[model samples]
Target chain A: MSDNAAPIQLFAKKARVYPKRVWGTFRKLKWASMVVLLGIYYLAPFLRWDRGPHAPDQAILIDMPARRAYFFFIEIWPQEVYYLTGILILAAVALFFVTSLFGRVWCGYACPQTVWTDLFVWVERIVQGDRVKRMRLAEARWGFEKIWKMALTHSLWLVIGLLTGGAWVFYFNDAPTLLEQIIHFDVPWGVMSWVLALTFSTYLMAGFAREQVCMYMCPYSRFQSAMFDKDTLIIGYDEKRGEPRGKYKKGDSWDDRGHCIDCTACVQVCPTGIDIREGLQMECIACGLCVDACDGIMDKLGLPRGLIRYDTTHNQEAREAGLKERSHLMRPRTVYYTAIITLVGAVMLFGLMNRAPVELHVLYDRNPLFVKLSDGRIRNGYDVKILNKAHEDKVYSLSVKGLENVEIRVQGAGEIKADQLHVYADSVGHFRVFVVADKPADARENVDFRLEEVGGANAADYDGVFMSGKP
Target chain B: MSKNNEIDKVSGVETTGHTWDGIKELNNPAPRWWLIVFYITVIWSIGYWVVYPAWPTLSGDGERGGTQGTMGWTQYDQLKEQQAEIRARKSAYLERFENASFAEIRSDEELYAFAVAGGAAAFKDNCATCHGTGGAGSAGYPNLNDDDWLWGGDVESIHETIRVGIRSPHEETRLSEMPPFGDMLSGEEIADVADHVLALSGRAEDSEAGAQVFADNCASCHGDNGLGDSALGAPNLADAIWFYGSEKGDIMSQVRKPKHGVMPTWEARLDANTIRQLAIYVHSLGGGEE
Candidate 1:
């Protein structure tokens, strides 16, 4: 260690960012993204899908009590949780593909944190005035105007947070019913706790945490650079043209000077408060707001636009070298990601299309595996569970194979015939089945219990073993 | 450490007393919001300690032997509350079970399902020791799943037998006994009767002498065909399901000195609804008579 080495201070006070309001193409684009994303998030639960009378009518619902997940036309059983894995994989690869091409568009436009923070900032701006006024108010002494303005801003932020948390819970329950419960203040503790937790987190994260969440808390920002290539699009400064910059007068020299007028419009409008003219840093979200701000500045100064712009490193280098820039969209990374996305999507589609309406599970009795009857026959007991996934009651005829002279008898079925088992709609029917068979040559014999839906085409088979005393 | 107290010129913030090469560490404090949240958590922890049992008492003479917070919450109390909730949920079904007869219970699908589940749980706790967990009995005990039963197999008969057990201490118990004929009948006669009993099940050759001995000694309780009557709690000798071993020696020993098995009366132990549930569960095991 160096003798003059200083002991490091681990903590640093956060520098508050007050992004000034700007009217440009990217700003409009960001507003549109926020409106559309928040609209879908807040309104998605109210969208109704008819699942007949047996299932919930919510278009997208996670019925925790029923252990079922319904997505439009598809219903997911607890046993079929692989579909969730498939959906997650698809989402991940799609994000990778988009990141490799456009660079952090998700972070800029589509992320919940960004949208909510933008909304909160918009509210703050509307209540307390824009950047300079907000800074002045923060530095000003305590007063009624400051107190009222700050209170109004926080109240609006809290209301938005409450709505956001409230909308999130509607996805897990029936929307209209839960809305009624919430109106009446009759929400269960389990649901109320989740609502409060999400409310507090949303309020804190969007209102105060803001860009600090992106800079330190978000894992995506830390690792997203791994997906970048030279051709990956990013927000950067054209240092080749912007350097040797000085303030422009009404009439300035056109020789040996850059077009940049040293106006800090880009930095003033940046949400993360990092100067884009310093070149691309990890804090840059690639939102292109800096480009919009610089373009406005260039138009005012009667100079060419794009001192800061969205460009690939390769293109920037090519432009510096006086060569034509080209884009490579078919790189191996993108190709692999696309292939995986397509394969997983196809597999999930096939599985959903061919999902069976009936499933059988058989558990052989362990204690006293085989009982000897008075007729000198051996019987094996099984607990058979039939999951009827359809919307109507179904009677399934059960039979056993791989054992000679096997007779199936169901307990508690009364006069409904020994082989016919009745299963209710969209529920599991548990039956204690006794399979009587002649003594097998081996101590344990493999048997298959075949269940065929009466008057229907669906069938399921469960493999089980029949135990007997050694002859 | 040295005390240079150098100032960083770029951001106009004071640096730490020490410097490395040309770079100095700035002494920037944490954000005010972070400090506020830290203080809030500290206050919350104090409140939590005041409301919950957070500390252990050194003295063993305390009521709880530890710090009992104002809330006075205990894991046992939580368990009891959870159990009470479950019992309240099942109270409706239990009321229906108490009011309904065996036939009515079997007819109603929900009531039948509840009975079976409750009965299976109770059976595992009480009856699974002597009878196997699945009711496949040992050599002395009878297999509940088999067609042959010493008493009766119907649900009502099973209920009555469970209430006042076979040869139990209860006054109304189903009592039957096979007398030990070792002194009355000679050794040769006992062997002959044992052979006749085995022959009734086709396990041995039928002999005239064995038939006479069986009619004289066992025919009073065991019927003429050797199919013992359920009314008398006499086991059927004609079936392959035997309470004791079916070997020639075992039959001869039983004829000489019969072993009687007693089942405890459940009326004194279980509630009426539980006894009925057990009866239904036993009857549903596949061999209950119509």
Candidate 2:
């Protein structure tokens, strides 16, 4: 907006932000969120489960070998993949719901990118002696001191990245057992490769990429406009108090001037480095670091805080008119989002509760639909798939009925148990079963292949179709 | 600790000049590194945008979108290579086994191991649901891995089980059936002999009265010693193996209520060598009779 027939500089020299640190309610909330969220991310993988001798004991695991996922007391088999669909739906709805209540809180504190980058920036400040030393060091040529600082900082970032990647594989197996394998250099090459890839990606994204992830690469940022409304509580600057921002001369007093001293501390503390006072922006993570910085400034200036704070637009405008007041947020958008969240969560939980532990699939062989025996009887072949989803081995007995002249011949069934077959826990076992009809069955006839559990724990029945020829 | 400094800080910056817990803040400039970082990050980001598929490409040629990137790398390519490697290994083993007889393959250590691995996977894919892991053979499904053979345990017989299957329609398919003993004998008599049959397997029970019952009815199919006849498809009663079950109660129940297992022939679905490998695995199951 700068003008007067002169080309504006694409870049401008600006004052550096020296946030005189302060404390208040919003700052405390941000500190709490940082602690809780980071704590969960770095620690959740270590939780344990006790799934007996045969199963992996990680409390939350995605056991690709067993083809079952475990979470505390619940285990999901491959057949129950719909639960994953339900989870994804629920997550989307929950994101919408939260955004409706407090816009971009996830961006502000909970997002993995935000959380890690915040940590990384904190580490940078600690190691390089804050903003000044880091800038001077970058501008200066490489030296022993500069090199050591860079090396130390990068090594710390790599360690955090490694930890992040290391925790991921622990979700797929027994964490302790896998850790031992990793330590002993005996892990599968795929696991090691995945670890390396994840570590590298995490380090690059959180350490170097930082806010750019949200600004450019994230699809959520582009699509999220649909979820936001005027009632959403977003980090907004009050132009009524802060603008016509100007610096007071030596003898000026508060009565004759506007509240803002134009210090730019809010701009400096921002991880995304966008000015809140300029207005709302897509780049702002809404982290409230600005609010902390500005509130500290205001306490010193003998003026009210919240020059930059979470407020709705209507309230921001009202306050600009020197009429500050609270606004209601439980409007239509919030109600709709909350309803969807509740609905999705309920459906997901219900599906998890009713999920079955066994599945049976049958494919009737078609090549030679039926063969006529010397006895003048006909036979039909069928391939049966029996999946055992229980946590222990189970033996199932299969039977066929409805056809009067039908007799079943499983290769070893007569010598074994006539109807019973056994399978290991959390596995699918296939078998070939021939249904020989003493008389011909109708073409494209379907018969029920019923499997009844005869032994072990968690006995259950599963059914599939037996295919045959024309009557 | 320094009231004069605290008062000066509050006087200009809008502070109360009143110190809280004696920690007064200085109005010093934020570190210069932070400012430099902000600009550097913006510049570096633009550079990255040019290299990776970070932005939507101007040309809709989906190479960086739906199609492969400039690197031409793809998950499909990786998967295809892995599959090709597996196929190479399998075809070599298959080539070796193709020339060998079923028995020869069974005895060959390396060949047998390869067969077992392939056969077990095939079983899991095609047979394990009914035949327990290790081919322990579930009830109503004969344990091909066991020594007790209703038809036989020879490579040809086992192959026939995997090929034409039991009671199957192949011209030379093995087929045997015993009329329900209940039809031939009274329910009471069937129960008595079922107990005696359980006793024959060295199981403990009241066999004193069951002997007469077995001599009259079961001898016809099971034969005199209850050794059974493969020709008749009756199972042997003396060797500690049971088709329906070895338990007295299970045997009695089967006698009271007859049951049968059904298996479809695999020859029509799979190739010849896979059947050979399956037979080899089953025959090598420690219980295969000569």
Candidate 3:
């Protein structure tokens, strides 16, 4: 501690960073990914699929009011929400598998934050000029030129944000009808409010939050190192070859000095404003932009490239120890992640293929458990619900088993097989049934009720109690 | 203040020289954009105060309580506007429901839904106290969501029941009385008759004696098979549904001195539209007979 230290102030000023543009392998990759991902996001809602006249035509739709979700050829009901959980687990494991091999690669290339931020920056460069001009304009007094440029940049950002948010709402409703309703200003207030909220958040996050989201807001950044090991590929600086870093002229002494000229070119092209020479850091997105920058400088100086490159810590250590560098991709962690991913995928596929076309729920009446009729017969009432999951109308015949001398009577449909009840496609049909039988003193507590489709697709069975003697 | 400020040794960044337990506090500022957002929200809040109902006054005298802002907005006004939006959305259905007969409303799916929703709201406010939520009735109150009906289960029968009610003071109320036999018969005879009635429901071990008594006295209103008479509003005694109770003692008490239930006349209280809605809603509760 300094003896002449001044009194502590609560806040310190922030240092703003203005990153310069550069051309490299990673930059080209990022550009290609941005175009592809944004294209898919913007165009997916317009894609159409035919499902006869009974269902909407949007290829991917979540019909919330009807409690149904349609994805291309598949339709999911509320009871099948476990499929979503399965998908989330699959995605998480895939991410872990990738992260174990290549550290922070997803964060750099495919993260929504990174993609949108890149787009925002590209727009900013087009509207406000390059890094130097932007910094000058930022430091310069607010003039009319600055105001117009800033306004134009923000307006374009808002447009992109609007498109992003608009695309999201299209998934929940019939896309064409909802689009018409939105155009006519006839949509529900909730829809308009959600669109507005999502638009503002997107604009704020992509345009302004930028690096702050990666540095502080995103939980993925905090726990990312948990998936990383010494063997994982990361953006690293060859300090032994680059440092003792200093400026060099054309004919400077090459006997003792490292190849690095201390140009700070790596820092100039960095999106997160981190110094790669400071070694591997949490801020490094592993974008490899610095590698291209340093490689360009090394070419000019006639030095071998890769002073800053994608390398594993173990490889770097081995190289320093005068051993050949190697990578281990088939590690135990990666194998385990791959195995789990494959297993989960196979199980979900099987489940979807063998999904039941019909479901039944039987609830025995509780108030008066059993009614003893004048003819010495005991009658039990049940409320049965049958879900017909097929795409057309169906007729189902109801029956009961697990009891002797039982007689079944559905309220609307009679006991005979010819008196089949018609159930609408993709809907549930409710019926009140009375199961009358002799009071067998030695009968089991529960009985099975079976509903078979009349010369149709499937069957469903439900278990109900045969309450006797009392409530 | 400048005397206590210094650059941190490790990071070479300036720190607020205040140290606690040998740990110094870095003075790094919050992001500039975050500060701008904070300022924007402050301005927005001030603007909100100007337009919305925000402040409170000592008098507490306003149209909807609290200090009225410049825009003169109230929560009640917003609620009314929201309701108007919903009404606009369902205007076609509402128009049909207003003009259609009960049969027509029942036949049309859209109109039926509109009526049922309106009836549900009305039922929650007026009928749930006695009829139970979703009309899963308690003892003595009929479970509307069942195949059993005292008078009838048709749409018109339900409409009539709601309009006049059962045992109400209204002139058109469905009226019935089971004369108390407590004073007319001996305790043994009452017990025997209750057992026979239980036998009719297949609950008793023997009903020979009570069957004789039932044939002599109860068979007039209750059919010989105890199937009940809808015209007289008598319940089917052999069905699992019981209005009063299912206990043997409950049956004996009913044979001795029956407790009659009364439902208030809705026509005297609710509007015609509401009554029709209730009738449609009750009819659609999975128990309506064709």
RMSD in Å for all candidates:
5.2, 19.5, 6.2
* Candidate 1 docking quality: incorrect, acceptable, medium or high: acceptable
Instruction: Give the Cα-based TM-score of candidate 1 against the true structure.
Output: 0.88
Q: Chain A of candidate 1 scores what in TM-score? A: 0.96
What local lDDT score does residue B242 receive in model 3, on the 0 to 100 scale?
A: 75
Q: What docking grade applies to model 3?
A: incorrect
Question: How many pairs of residues collide in each model?
Answer: 0, 52, 11
lDDT of 3 at A236: 89
lDDT, candidate 1, at A102: 92
Model 2 alpha-carbon drift over 4 Å, by segment: A1-31, A185-187, A249-251, A320-324, A412-414, A455-471, B1-290
**Candidate 1 C-alpha lDDT tens digits along A207-231:** 9999999999999999999999998
* C-alpha lDDT (0 to 100) for residue A173 of candidate 2: 71
Greater TM-score among 2 and 3 belongs to 3
Regions of candidate 1 where Cα sits further than 4 Å from its true position: A1-7, A184-186, B1-91, B185-196, B204-209
| Each candidate: chain B TM-score | 0.83, 0.68, 0.86
Weakest lDDT window of 10 consecutive positions for candidate 1 chain B:
B1-10
Which model scores highest in lDDT?
1
The digit string of per-residue lDDT tens for model 2 on B56-149 reads: 5457774445423455556677899999999997899889989987657756756877887787678778887787664656568766544568
Predicted structure with the largest TM-score when compared to the true one:
1
| Candidate models: Cα lDDT each | 0.88, 0.71, 0.82
| Better-scoring candidate (DockQ), 2 or 3 | 3
